[model samples]
Target: MSRNVREAVWSPDREQIRNMKMYRLMEKNGIADYDEFFQRSVGDAAWFWEEVTKDLGLEWFRPYRQVLDRSDGAPWPKWFVEGKINAAHNCLDRFVKDPRARNRLAVIWEGDDGEVRKRTYRELWTEVNAFARGLKQLGVGRGDRIAIYLPMVVENVVAMLAAARIGAIFTPCFSGYGAEAVATRLKDCKAKVLVTADGFLRRGKTIPMKEEADKAADLSPCVEKVVVVRRLNRKDCPLNEERDIDWDVLMSNRKALSAEATDADTPFMIIYTSGTTGRPKGTVHIHSGFPVKAAFDAGYSMDVGVGDTLFWMTDMGWMMGPWMVFGSLMNGATMVLFEGTPDYPEPDRVWMIVDTHGVTHLGVSPTAIRALMKFGDRWLEGHDLDTLRVFGSTGEPWNPEPWSWLFEKVGKKKVPIWNYSGGTEISGGILSSNLMKPIVPCSFNGPMPGMDADVVDEEGHPVRGEVGELVVRQPWVGMTRGFWEDPGRYENTYWSRWPNLWVHGDWVQVDDEGYWFITGRSDDTLKIAGKRLGPAEVESILVDHPSVVEAATIGVPDPDKGEAAVCFTVLKPGVAGDENLKRELVTSVAEKMGKALKPKEIHFVSDLPKTRNGKILRRAIKAAYTGKDAGDLSSLENPGAVEAVQQSSAN
Candidate 1:
């Protein structure tokens, strides 16, 4: 298993090659070549999506008059044209109809304090219904909006499904957000109601949220009601008799509410993903859009079928949170929701969850893998993680060292790491690793089915073996309708680069074998002299050094060269980064990526600033280093990290 998974360890077992939905669909369509099948899928995306839903056995109240209606435009391609559907019905009601589905577990949640909660499909259905009735009682009807700010608890899922059940647009706010961050989203969406918790445990400490919610509600005049879930059973939790209500009081009756048959284009949730500056852009996903895409990616890429357990280390605010829930349940599979940091109480917490519950599919990030690798493989020694048939990765581009470590140590080189790269706007994945394929380290086999993704030069011409912008030439079912209340901005952001293609802002390369590797965000590309390379390319080489735990490379303005690459690295706990070690890190990058692409300066820092979801904030890092404004840093988990980088740069 320790052998390199890039080449030697790609002998997939017979079970791995079995007919899944995509394979069967291709075979049925008389498409023999996988590549040609993808081309045909792009050629007739509408037919392909209709076929996909049919294969998934999805039901709709009113069948679509047209498979797709691009009458509006490509940027706003309407899917399931003139169709009627409800996301919650497909996820909950359909599953609850079958006794086998209802009896199976839907979600298994674990808190940092050893508190565990499990809900079967039947139980989840009842709870969602009860919550829906509660919302109805509170006058939350169709077209109304609600905001949810809670920890990774079962109630969060219930609230989301309830909102979707009643056709109310809901946004899952990151529980760690400050009052301003929460209020901005609430104000933008004009959320009428907010579902939150008193507080949740983190690192054995209670992080209060009631006060923050109270402050945010005050700031957002549109919010009329605030429902507080009494987590930890805090009797003295903050309460506003005029506006705030208890969770139990709201969900008192085990009443049932009928799922609203919403128009296929009805926006179900508004997920706010912060940009480099300005207010966070709320990516509006619809009833049939995000869910279908998520389920398709999970089912096709990881083979997450009924009875399998899927766990993605993510937050409710992040795309993967909703992705895992809708994807797994729609596939009739169970989802694992664990709250708290993966290494807080124990380094083996992630493995423990997989072992305790039979997690057939496990999704993680490269940052998490790098951090875990620092603790050595001893923590993973005694755990039996045989249930992990497939590994999933997202969030950021992977460095080869951590990628190899994950394949070797956790997977034992037996399972494929299903690397997926996409965003909240896309709902699922643009480029994803498939079950029936060979995997090169830190690379994707190709674009996911139904996606006509390609690497294009600045002029929109396809480039081979050279880094370029990742673009989608054809429309897909899961593409975001548009940014909330800013269709013009959405058009400018995605479609303006090319006539109709979606410029995804990612820098990618396609090898001769057609394996795609996402280098980093295109905006994060470093132009050192004449060579254009991504920061991840330089950072990956830096992280390969023994002392470097993780690295963030940024392109700083230079005197001779227009811009030069500079690295800010955090060393392993036991390792020190002296001048000699810094020189070694620089030399390693030079040796790996050629001397022309070498960094102008290499600074060792105590920490690298990152979002709560573990993405390195290069913009924040460059801002702090350059003494420039770091705009809209509410998404940042640690302010101290930025200051540490600034101090290191000064030194």
Candidate 2:
């Protein structure tokens, strides 16, 4: 085992271990060993999920006849068979029954310019019911699609629940997506209504969201009605009298709409995730599937519970937004939504929010941490974050330096950072840090309980102590039903690689100590001189230098080698990108990763293109540098970064 894997940075004490939901579940089931319980979870999905839902106190209008039915296949397995449930009912209605729970804070929101908003469970339920009635007044019904295109606000969550309450499917587009990108999703789902804001604040600037919503609605002829949130109250806010309605006007009806009793397999959400070579693929998530699984992961893995606050810096379009919402609400914990960049106004904005909100479980991306780390530890000095118990990280692989910085500085070497890995299609994490297990820097304890995950060679055989393909051998409750209107594409994307095995596109490594590390996306892997390389591996080496803030590596066409590695780096402020520094970085990688894997060249730029959730757009970077088509840039948070990359290539 490597030195990092051998040395565990964090471990749970007896009290911490006893308090964990996973440990309690094991004890309740008479299982003394965690590894044994994990094996049984995968060995018997039915028993495991039954115990989990029972533990969650899940109530069903109609009880499930069976736990799982895989007669069709692994990809199409039906969970909680014959059960009738509603997502909004579980998320809101059940909590309202208890007088104490009803008044507890459920959603805490922060705007770009430091404005704050808080909604109790009762208040959130009231808004949801009103919006449900509004959606019904517009003639929306079960299975009807609603496209939500708005910033991170309380209204976005309201729109989602209201759609679910009425049995309508809602798809969220990134708040920063352009008109064309928004229109594409509207067209694909043939949405009946669009929920948007007039405008919202971002970095102290007013973004006219209604203008893009209007343009997108113009292109999507299927959109029959548009609901405007009047967030900015702009005087020039255009409205089509025939099809547009103001949110306050529509919500004039304060009556509650009865929740529909949807079957377990009934689809409630269709989240569209962008692929490398095609239009976004809509991943279908069901009532019982996503909510139940996400809640389980949050409670069992992260140890979230009642009265706790869980905050993830994310947008509604990203999977983590919904993941945070469902997980926190279902677990009776408060969820925090932020509408601006973590570093906006000041470098300490994120830490300030956590301290102000009393956040117990905080989630952030490595890229965001790397950016904040440049501001140094001074920004974090004044914040009192004693309430923080754990940190959640996702979106991309972590570099050890940033991981250590977050662990040592922000966490005060007390809180553990849970490295979470999953995709939109999976609903929640395939791999996550368990509170019961010791944490290695930037390494997952193992697969999330019941994942049945393994690292495998090309022939589907298991491999350890080396990097290989990440695969899951069994279907869990959270697997996507299929891509919307594209079952063939879904099967081809995941299942065609191996029989009854899901080839999750991430390249992973399992050390001898059983700690797991995600390298990067398999599609993003670079091959130089017949050797495979994960960009994160090279990026980690480059970022180890004090001058480099971030780095991305890509393979380009080569005459001798099959492909050669080309690197782009974003430097710390005022650092000179001289030839000497470039040579130093090259030698650093060559010494650590060996000479054959050395980067052919390195270009320093102002920024790296990233999604709203802070995942580096390495594909876009490669495309811009090589003069190729950069497919599906709608998820990009900064389009100018791509232009900067192109300019660098020219220079």
Candidate 3:
């Protein structure tokens, strides 16, 4: 299969032809061009969003009379106020009623042990209904919070939908999170029920998730029951007869449950963002408009249609899970869910899943691509990837080498790389590259259909050719209502920078061609000798070096300079990290971004600390280097990365 895929790799020109077809589709859909859409989006934000929501077939119990109510100011802009709808209805019920979709595949789960599980929309609806009934039997109700601590299995998805079905706000904790992290979110949300699995497989090893849930339950007084799904047959799994319930037993006795009728503004989910400076903020997304916006962006921007199978490398804990599930299902598309590391068994495990399932749209992170690129094209030599139509990237800025490699090798340059940017607060992408736009490495084409995004200077004036903070001028459907139980914090965090505009915290620049480049986080901007520099600009130059696999730059306090640049780098596999390679990397950054922005210290590390969603935590690195406590290490995929950095700092 790998050989077949290698042979089918088309030249650059052939790839261009494929992209042209995607552009034609956009034109057919009334977006004359990417630029036209961008102009209309900023000029007529409300109208543009209304059109997108309607086109996505979002059915509201009470349709919105107005698209937005911004008279209250940007900080308090009310969206779809008069509308009433349920997110679960938009994601599941709609598909259940459609005959063609009823028999169509909803989720294709691939276990780490090579076991495959399939669920059709009809079957998925039944399971979700039963789960909802079980929650009700346990005294869970609307406005209540349910914490889910499970792996990437079908049950996790079912638990989420079931919670939404009954108007219970769901909060998912990454199965990899330790007991402390899980307990923090549980206490914050006052979760009444905790959903977990007995165990799960990771890299062919068993992880006892139920034990972690048990520990969390011990600390959280709000938890009334622990629902455990039997994933691995552990002989001595612990269970309390009073509070623990077997997942199968509960579902077997419950009947199909009806969807709860709720207001559009009702809280749907609380997704915690990896807060590097303090406690992780529980970003609250609501029902109705949030699902509609996700569906619209995935369908129109990524060109996902009914019959297409979408697969994104993500876990149940991340916002991408909700984004992928709701967007694909609401659009009547199938989703491929994998329950193991991308490079588990072999370097080509992801490609195998793609070919085996005939996945059409595959979303991944830049970190994953960088890792795959190090393995070279040989890993993907012969896989049948003709089914793939679009490639999506999110989480962080991608370098040109990995981007071009992904385009030329995996996509054969035929698929458009949809670069997306948004946080868990928004539920989905605010800015993204559309199929019709010209391809650029690590750049977004424009904002989503309705988003009014702009790159502005510190004084709030628009900047076209220089790097500045990214802000949205108007409110959109998927914007978060507030932080869970912390409306004051939400106001101060998001809306404080600009009066009503949302300061996205991303430092970005838009070229004269209108191609948007994200430099890094606004907080990561370094002031070296009074000159401001973004970490992404420096990291991009470092990654351009052949020996460098990935790099992260952070500003550390300096005696001479107000802040000096410190770079942490990871070399390609088999390449040893040495002083010579570090010198080359530092020199390369000086040549690209200027000597003033060059790193004062370049240290080699095995890996950089990152969230599960694949964002490098620069603030964490800064804290470690400055001999300060690293806050909120909960979302880190590799906790060892922090110790590695600390060891390097001591040296």
**Among these predicted structures, which one has the highest lDDT?**
2
Q: How well is each residue in 564-629 modelled by candidate 2, as lDDT tens digits?
A: 889999999999999999999999889888899889999999999999899998899999999988
- Which sections of candidate 3 miss by over 4 Å? 1-34
* TM-score for each candidate, following the candidate numbering: 0.98, 0.98, 0.94
- TM-score of decoy 1: 0.98
Report the candidate with higher TM-score, 1 versus 2: 2
| Residue 405, candidate 2: C-alpha displacement in angstroms | 1.1
- Misplaced by over 4 Å in model 1 are 1-8
Worst 10 residues of 3 by lDDT: 1-10
Question: Which digits, one per residue and each the tens of the lDDT, describe model 1 over residues 133-169?
Answer: 8898889999899999999999999999999999999
> What is the lDDT, from 0 to 100, of the residue 259 in candidate 2?
93
Q: What is the model-wide C-alpha lDDT for candidate 2?
A: 0.91
lDDT of 2 at 90: 92
Least well predicted 10-residue stretch by lDDT in candidate 2: 1-10
Model 3 agreement with the true structure over 238-284: per-residue lDDT tens digits: 98898999898769745667788777678889988766567889988
Misplaced by over 4 Å in model 2 are: 1-6
Question: Residue 170 in model 2: shift from native, Å?
Answer: 0.5
